[model samples]
Target: MLYRFKSQATADLVMLVADAQGALRLIGKDLTPEGVISPDQLPWAIDILQHAWREDNDLGLREDTYATEQLAEQDDENPDVRLSQRLVPLVNMLELANKAQVAVVWSAS
Candidate 1:
């Protein structure tokens, strides 16, 4: 899947993803130039993606806790509420990772 961002602050940035044979599978175009992201920053991007993917696929009812908490805050006490709270940490980590990646890229030029 390609992700695109557009803003008035800068020119567009495009990220092209291809297969081993250089076959283009995804193209993230028109992305607000978050600046020049280098290959060295890929590790952190991969880390963030991996973590988010893991959290999304978590089957141990961990993420459910955060959802549960959210519902509980509304005074709806359901046992299933415990399953929703885990999203908080997952979201926080993802945000941090994104910011780090952006910072790295923005600092480039």
Candidate 2:
């Protein structure tokens, strides 16, 4: 399954359900069928996500829950994709939505 995030301020964003859920979980959101992040909430959401990403990158504390040993090994042999990397697009979308005073919404499919 996939989640499609829409924002009046930015292009539509699509992500695998796992990736979207991982990031949303950081901000205390569940991967429901649909949801919204209001403009007022964007700053806090962005902060939480960026902080978690930084901590994961700098301290390597959080396990990449989506990755298995086999995938980890494959990543080592190829270009790596980290939680931090996966969160960037979502963060960018939120930032833009905040600036434009619009809401960010997502629906599971």
Choose the strongest candidate by lDDT: 2
Model 1 residue 70 CA deviation (Å) reads 23
Backbone clash count, each prediction separately: 15, 0
lDDT tens readout by residue for model 2, 1-109: 9999999999999999889999888988866899999888899999999998897676443344444555766765553577788899999999999989999999999
Q: How many backbone clashes does candidate 2 have?
A: 0
Give each model's whole-structure lDDT: 0.36, 0.86
Give the poorly placed runs of model 2, Cα more than 4 Å off: 60-76
Give the range where candidate 2 is weakest over 10 consecutive residues by summed lDDT: 59-68
Candidate 2: TM-score?
A: 0.81
